[model samples]
Target: MKKRTVADRGADGSERPRHCADGMPNTTMEVHVMHKSIRTPHADTRRRAAGGELIGSQEANGTHAWRGIRYAQAPTGPLRWRAPQPASAWDGVFHALAHGPMAPQYAGLLAPVPAKLYGRIVGDEDCLSLNIFAPAWASDAVPAGVQRRPVMVWIHGGGNAVGTAASYDAARNYAAHDGMVVVTVNYRLGVLGWFRHPALHEADSGTAEERSGNFGTLDLIAALRWVRDNIAAFGGDPGCVTIFGESAGGQNVLTLLASPLAAGLFQRAIAQSPVAETFSVHEATERNDLPLESQRTSAREVVARLWTAAGKAPDVDAADQALHATPATDLATWLRSLKPEELLSVFKPGSVGICLSPRPVRDGVVLPLDPLPEVFRHGAWNRVPVIIGSNRDEYRTFLADKPEHVRLLFGKLPLLRDRAEYITESNFYSQAWRSLHVEEPADAMLAGGHADVWTYRFDWDEAPAVPFVRPDILLGAAHGMEMAFAFRDTAGELDIFGINTSSNRAGRRAVAQAMGDAWTSFARVGVPRLSGDAQWQRRTHGMAAETLLIDSPAGGGLRMAGVRQDIASLKASLRLSPQVSSGESRCRIYARVFLWSPLFAGLGSEQEYAELGREFGCAQPASVFRQLTEV
Candidate 1:
């Protein structure tokens, strides 16, 4: 037997710590922990890339989970606004048991939940962690001929500002039952994660990928690197990794496709209703509704304004000048020095009409000047088998929001006076329901010889309505509704759709089964097939866009909606819609729903909103026009 020799003890008999392969020092001692969540007798031993061993808990259902594992070091203090660094090595066995802390965010960001059943939570800066779930079939090792399951890395969506790795618990998903592995990740959020300043740019001596700003994106890249290096231990194919995210997470997935820094980290990708908007860094940094360009907001301007308003500085202008003159290193130090609360006050949610958080920058280094155009037109992005889709009723979640603004501008429409109304598929005055969301971007990805781009439209709207004003209108497979069905995550089951008797239980179950299988199958072989044997086809031609409409209400089978037929249907719907004004304005009630899609954009044009207003006959109040002029 080869005897393991350690360095001799010091004069005082203190043992020397062993060094990790990653150069992080650690004590050469193993830890034994019986994770409480482990219901099974057998625990899996997984080794981390940084030389830490993990005792993963086995589920009663024959699955295994390694929760709250830090993919990167705690991004705090000096590391606050910088890219994520490597996680340090630990001497004892790191118990991948409890979920990690989430990035700091405002409360109530989650889909409405039953507080009694699922407790409300806060966040912390020490939150760059991830959770891995593998099927019971995926033991520590597989035979030479046996294939390792594909890894699906989940990035939760809360507008790149909120949400955590622990937000959705899908222990019952296909990944846990089928031959696959799932990983949910947490990255920095809000001002802490995406903030960038001209001053912080001073010390950027590293490569373009090391550029500051968009630290949240950087954290994601870092997590992907960690997964690529370490997911094998969990019985995953490091090479065959797919990143799937919804909403903001979907946007991140698309961004990753465009990011040179994130190249080769992932293979296949799925983006669910990504917030598709790309603008220049200046366009992002500037204020939306403000009058003066000089008063446009950025981290520097906000810090200066907040400091001056708080009486720390002599005045606002002087503070701005001082901040501009501040050294780059000192600028980062000073920004980190300010109270998190104070910094957040500068750009709180709903401060403006929009959720204008610090957007991902188009810094010449990390992100190109224009990503989508370059990718689709110039062909400069990481091409992979991609699935991009959106719900049938996406704007329903924010229906009341836009309508509320309209109500505030022009006195409430008599039709929707009392109701917190939004656009819907209801046949209001012969107008049929239509949606253009998430389709335009999908069309942009139909480049030949690039990737097999499969498009989908989730049209089931049988979700249980919660406290939302109108369950009928607000709960139609709205934005982010598919996540629960995709991961089979029922954490917010009760509050999200009131699972008791309101929701279609059997339908939800069926949809969940189909979607889960589709996702897993896609990860397995880059194609999504339904249980009923209908294949999801790709859109090859520009106008011949074909999508697999994943719907249960219309029928429990795949309904292929070809773009050619869809265009004809849209024209028919528009022709049926009234073009002239009627009593109390029919356009006000239906324009947002039927005319608000890119598919229907040519029909609506830039004058659609005005045309709708004209048809309503109830011209927008003079006050509303005045308000617009003032702005």
Candidate 2:
């Protein structure tokens, strides 16, 4: 290993440490000079590059934490809505002392009555920054190689609108335990990133032609490029990299899979609940109803309307200046000055609102076409192994907020919600009904694979006791619930999954260990394998295969029952039925009966159950149930 000296910057940028890769300077010694007062670039100690700074402890892990490294120049003035440009390199060792500001915030869709109270404050225009957390240079945690440790690039999620990489705390997973270099990045969000214009596309012309949209995704690619070139200095292996995320980040991973620019960047990917959708530039442009100029025209009109409403001359430059100089509080107050309906009419219209006007542009270059079609075609990605699945009650979070609202839609029968709610509530009565029941639709989505999809239901419902909300009563493994388990993380005053009891804790730990192992192992090799003979089976596209359920005990025994067969029959019937879309198919009709039939069977209402099945459109003989016995 090359010897190095490091030092801490003392306010006016002066080095402080004496000499210590090891305390003893003779035997196997190397000194990391904390800071060199000289302010010389390479003359300070070790490797030199562009503007960079050291962080973390050299003595502890030989890892230097480089905070807020700029990947792109500030997208302001003329550069706004234009493609990102590489940041200009600096001469001396510039200080990367603080995290760069996040992208300028916007009042998002449905941004409450009191606007400031609705969402987070907007940040700076120069928000294209990244944070690196790696093992310090002198630590024993460094991977055994001439190259540095592997890198894991994490992209945070906020519906492609409201999240930041800074929100995630890596104290437990990436920074402390994994021992790999972890990079969390920030990019433009909402309109700032996804805005488009015909003039902007025309500006690029034939030579330096650029896509008019998907700038946020391009930012991710830029960050990966930075990692490929510079990670070696921080003892990170550039070759072995894994890109992982959830929600929009998951969507971003799917986007990366389809992006030709991101072709050779990542070795493997894990997409958790990737949303399948199609976005188009034409569709995006239509949202604003821009008269050929897109957002610029829209912005101009909005400024005119706002100024006129405020009884001032509708001066565009003055409005722009006001927007720039005004405090966040003032912006909210100014916005509130207008009537809600008046503001909505001018800025937002019907469902196609201003806030989501120009979303991730589907320009031909950066985003060639609809990504979903490419993914469904399967050849678009490099065919690298992928791990994809959703939580058990994936749709539960969607319904959790409004029980009355949910009842309006789901309570009307010939649906799965009522039955799912019943089965979920059945757990309170006894463990008997809760034993090994699988929801039909979830099973169908898992089984109908175009790739090697590993399915899991995060059933570790160990939440805190709030009034009216019971873990068993409401939110049975809701959407996004698995994120906590996958990261094995906790949030809020209490751990988000307040799994208090020893049994619950043990279950959480076991599931966490299983998931963490699956993730890291998949990153290392292409396939994720379990420790024992407990193989992580690949769910095929056609047949209903077994899924590894991460329940109480880590490697608990498999389900002895035949729930998959029942699900398979239901799926097959739906595809064959003529009444499929009408919500009255035999499959749908039988599904409800299947959930409650066993209950009636015990009460000698077996004949009544059979007659009910006839009413529900079960075309087959119902008496075959009495002939079969449990193994």
State the C-alpha lDDT per candidate: 0.60, 0.49
**Poorest lDDT segment (10 consecutive residues) of candidate 1:** 17-26
Show the colliding residue pairs in model 1. 436-597, 464-497
Query: Highest lDDT among the candidates is held by which one?
Result: 1
Instruction: Write candidate 2's Cα lDDT for 104-216 as tens digits.
Output: 44333222124443433456667888877654444344443434555678776555655566554332254344556677788776555664533344444412224455678
Index of the highest-TM-score prediction: 1
Put down candidate 1 lDDT per residue, 1-631, tens digits, no spaces: 1112242345766443221111111123211222234332245445454548776666544466778888888877877777788998888777777788877665553622234422223468898898887655334353111255677898888767667767665533544446567788989877777766665556545345545477888999999888877776666776677899987798888888878888878778898877654446665454343432212455656667776867878976788777667677776666777766566555544311122356577776567677563555465677767888877666555443444333432442212334323342323211222223255455566643453677777777764444424454544656667787786543343134443242566666677777877787777666676877677777666535387777665455566776333334554544355542342334443343334321122344326445645644656532232111101
> Candidate 2: where is the Cα deviation over 4 Å?
1-50, 56-64, 91-98, 106-120, 139-147, 203-209, 287-357, 375-379, 403-457, 464-467, 490-503, 554-631
lDDT of 1: 0.60
Question: Which TM-score value belongs to model 1?
Answer: 0.77
TM of each candidate vs. truth:
0.77, 0.63
Residue 520 lDDT, candidate 1, scale 0-100: 70
